[model samples]
Target: MRRSREGYEIYPVADAIGGISPTAHDNAMQRMIQAGAQPVNAISLVAELQRDWGRARADELRSILRWYFPKLQEIRAQN
Candidate 1:
C-alpha cells in the first residue's frame, strides 16, 4: 500500500499473499486496493508478463510455468 502511494505500480498476487486471519486478509486487500494496488492471481501475472507467445523469452516463460504450475500446462494442453 505504501508502495502504491509512492507511485509504484503494485501487483499483489492474491493467492500468494496471506494474513493471520481471513478477515485480516480481506481488510488488507481492501486497503491495498484503496491505495492503488492491482491484485492478480499467479497465472494472470505470468500471462501479463508473457504477453507475446513468439517473444524470445517465450520458451523460458513456458518452462517456468510448467515447473511451477503443472496444472496450467495441463489446462493449456486440454485446450
Candidate 2:
C-alpha cells in the first residue's frame, strides 16, 4: 500500500464500494486486476473488526487524531 499526505489511499476498495450498479464493486475489482492492484487479504486499520484496537493501530489512530483533532493531544501510552 502506498502512503500519501492525505493518508493510506484505499483506491480500488473505495471505488469498489462507491458503486452505483449491483456489480459496480465487481467492476471495480476488475479494474484493479487490470491495473495489477489485486489484494491478498483484508486487515483492519482501526476500530470495528480490530476490537479494542491493537497497539500498532492505536498509534496510528493517535497520529490520525493528532493530525485532525489537535485538542485531543497525546492518547496516553500503549497498554
Reference-based lDDT, each prediction: 0.84, 0.51
Number of backbone clashes in candidate 1: 0
- Candidate 1: tens digits of C-alpha lDDT, residues 4-69: 545788889987889999899999999888887889998898888788999987999888777877
Name the 10 consecutive residues with the lowest summed lDDT in model 2: 39-48
Per-residue error (Å), model 2, residue 34: 1.7
Candidate 1, pairs of clashing residues: none
**TM-score for each prediction?**
0.59, 0.33
Instruction: Tell me the TM-score of model 2.
Output: 0.33
By lDDT, the best candidate is 1
Q: Which of the numbered candidates is closest to the native, going by highest TM-score? A: 1
- Global Cα RMSD, each model: 5.5, 13.1
State residue 78's C-alpha deviation in candidate 1, in Å: 22
Q: List candidate 1 segments past 4 Å from native.
A: 1-3, 55-60, 63-79
